[model samples]
Target: MALPPADDLPPLRAVVEAHGLAPRKALGQNFLFDLNLTAKIARSAGPLDGFTVFEIGPGPGGLTRALLAQGAERVIAVERDPRCLPILSEISARYPGRLEVVEGDALETDLAARARGTPAKIVANLPYNVGTQLLINWLTANPDAPFWTSMTLMFQKEVGQRIVAAPGSNHYGRLGVLAGWLTRSEILFDVPPQAFTPPPKVTSSVVQLTPLAERLACDLDRLERVTHAAFGQRRKMLRQSLKPLGGEALLDRVGIDPTRRAETLSVAEFCALAQAL
Candidate 1:
């Protein structure tokens, strides 16, 4: 018998059940099989016509189907789970030339090279465990040669807060500083834990990041080093905590108050300290 039409393909629930594909917590898999939500995410990416979209962890092809339906010129989906490959292939077949599946770890793939041939945009509900690291890698790619023009990705509420957190906020830390230095980030909307197939304990949110035309004019390596040291002891004052990086001396070189804590420092101030190092 001919397979069900791609657009008319069985719901993700049916597909998962037919395949006996329970989401693997170890892989950080929480399948978002809700078509309405997936379509909403796709639409939020905006004007995908002629745009090459890159998706990570397309479990059960919910987001993949949405992108294809929304007129994306082409979509390259990277999936690590071998079990999910067949499901994605069904999507590839349904969409024909529009969908391509790359079965491998997203972290190891060279996304920049993948984007070399097309105008790319990244939209996905990222796996919880490795989402931040993947984002950092993507943002730190050659800034001059941007791979994806923008990112519409999801993260746990706490991670989302850190991504868009401002100085002096309790959520502000290494992630905030780095994200601020690299991109313009905002929390688009919240998704309750119940939205996932196997609900995560914490709420999740969509975060959209557009890389800045120019970097924050600080040494990234040093900035990360300083933030790592400072936030590593978040509760301690700079004089006491930054002691490892030169302590009060380090603050003096940067012209910052030794008594100030990491949370109190602005991104610019943090950048300055990183440069001073």
Candidate 2:
């Protein structure tokens, strides 16, 4: 039977019990059974009338149902856990052409190419262990012509803070520089640990990142090299920490103080260093 738009989807708990699926910690699965919370997250992506939502780890399909019900034109949900495949298949059947379940690890998949030529919005209750890596991959992939229009994702609260962190904060590091340079990121809301099926120890937050229409020209590889070297020895002054990447000579040429630490350097400074490298 065709599901009634998004309204007829069963309660997530019922579905989970019926399927006898217990979220697997090894896979970083934390199912969100609450419709209200899922709907809130889905709405954070704004109206999805013409967007393809690329979701990672749509366990039991809570957020998937929300995305579909909210009128997303299409949703390409990538699942790594085989246990969730049949559940996801049921969701796909309900929505018909609107949902595509790609059975594979999101880390190894090239989602951008799959959605090629089409604008997409990535919204997911990302698997905690792989969430940061996935975000980095999406941001660093052909930034000049990004596949997704925006990304509203869930992450550990600390990771969310790091994404929007400014220079001089403890949270500021390579992630802050990358996100600061490429997108406008903000913490949308906090989702308490109790919200999950088996609550995590730390709280979680939803972060939304919208890419800049124009970004400074910088080679991604060089930028990563510069950040890895600098932040790798973050406590040491740039003179000592950046020794691998030309150290004082590079800082001197760029008008930066070699005595300054990595945590205090602005995103622009990092981009400058990357360019000069």
Candidate 3:
């Protein structure tokens, strides 16, 4: 049986048509109109009774509606697309004071300040092109104390795998190292390509990342430098791939085997190397 409508408002399809809002390729837009899926994505962030949700790219407000209906205390949606503003405005009207639509680029918006030190959860079907960069920004933003309590995001399957990939795995790289260093991340579920409006070519997955109460102490810049050099030539031995960064000597000083490949090094090992640098 079909799930009941998430809210009393018009269906997402009608909302999309009425607003003449088509997904734009330049913005990496792919509309997810399934209320069931959107609700599931919102719930994956855990209980929303008192937490404010920071959502990016809420096109036509499908996920916005689900989050409000699911009882999120407040939703601060940052949307870059001017065309989506009015559509989201309608939903804001429906929900009264529960929604705040910020019309601006998410990259330029300071989410930490917008959240105003409240316990916040970031839940969004992130745009594909800028997803990884966005994740990197959030991870490196405040190492001492993350701006948000938790993040539940959607990415292409490959990107999601990289976020949760382990040492010695094919997907392990800079992303996994940074994410592992700061948060405990995992792939919650895979979303098939067919589920989207202008269905994407590849499958997508939802990943959840919870901040570690106590993170390892290491220079974030140094870690990025090491990972960039090591993975820049992943197939090469550490001694060869990282030659520019004091290479073999640096690894030897850290007591790491210079012959080990980037993918074979654990997150802790990487942190040690970064500290040695």
Q: Which candidate is the best by lDDT?
A: 3
**Model 2: per-residue lDDT, tens digit, 1-277?**
3333346767788888998999999999998987888888998999999888899999899999999989999999999888888888888888899999999999999988888678899999988999999999999887888888899999999999999999999999999999998999999999999999899999999999999988888888998999999999999999999898899999988999999999999888888999998
Candidate 2: C-alpha lDDT: 0.91
Would you estimate the TM-scores of all the predictions? 0.93, 0.96, 0.98
Local accuracy of candidate 1 as per-residue lDDT tens digits, 9-116: 789899999889999999999988778888889989989998889999998999999899889999989998999988888878888899889999999999778776
Give the lowest summed-lDDT range of ten residues in model 3: 1-10
Across 13-126, the per-residue lDDT of candidate 3 in tens digits comes to 998999888999999999998899999998888998888899999989999999999899999999999999999999999999999999988988889898888899999999
Model 3 spans with C-alpha error above 4 angstroms: none
- Better candidate by lDDT, 2 or 3: 3
- Runs in model 2 with CA error above 4 Å? 1-6
Top TM-score model? 3
Each prediction's Cα lDDT score? Answer: 0.89, 0.91, 0.94
Residue 176 local lDDT, model 1: 93
Q: Which has the better TM-score: candidate 2, or candidate 3?
A: 3
Q: After superposition, how far is residue 106 of candidate 1 from its true place, in Å?
A: 1.1
Q: Sort by lDDT, best first: what order?
A: 3, 2, 1
What's the number of clashes in each of the models? Answer: 1, 0, 0
